[model samples]
Target: MLNVLSILIGLLSLVIVIPAQIPFLGIANWIALPFIVVGLVIGQLSSSNGGRNLCLVIFAVAVVRLMLGGGVI
Candidate 1:
């Protein structure tokens, strides 16, 4: 159950992240970061690592995007 919740959160964050990939919309990643973190925490509570891993990957993408935008774009 926790894993499912985490994956759902990851997907929701991914929705925000997809739009944030656009040049001027990187700030959306900032918004999504909290959601990603929440997912990560929840994922950690579950027996399986799949949800945790998914959240980690999404977190990496968002961080890289923020870096490329110099924190804001």
Candidate 2:
């Protein structure tokens, strides 16, 4: 379910964050953002703290990317 997707997108985010400046791939993070948000919402719907925590970590990484001016530019 969403827990699995959250984990997958979370890992994907790590890779995307690094190569986000590669022109065509620069939109990768932006694309993943929706998936990440979906995962977060779905994770919250579940009762497991682990799922929510993983989503949060993904969110944190997204935030860090923004703070570092890593958004699509």
Score each candidate by Cα lDDT: 0.96, 0.64
Assess every candidate by TM-score. Answer: 0.98, 0.62
Please give, for residues 1-73, the per-residue lDDT of candidate 2 as tens digits. 6576666665665566557645445566676677667777877776665666776776676666655555644
Predicted structure with the largest TM-score when compared to the true one: 1
Clashing pairs in 1: none
lDDT of 1 by residue, 1-73 (tens): 9999999999999999999999999999999999999999999999988899999999999999999899988
Off by over 4 Å in 2: 1-18, 21-26
Off by over 4 Å in 1: none
lDDT of 1: 0.96
Q: Give the TM-score of candidate 1.
A: 0.98
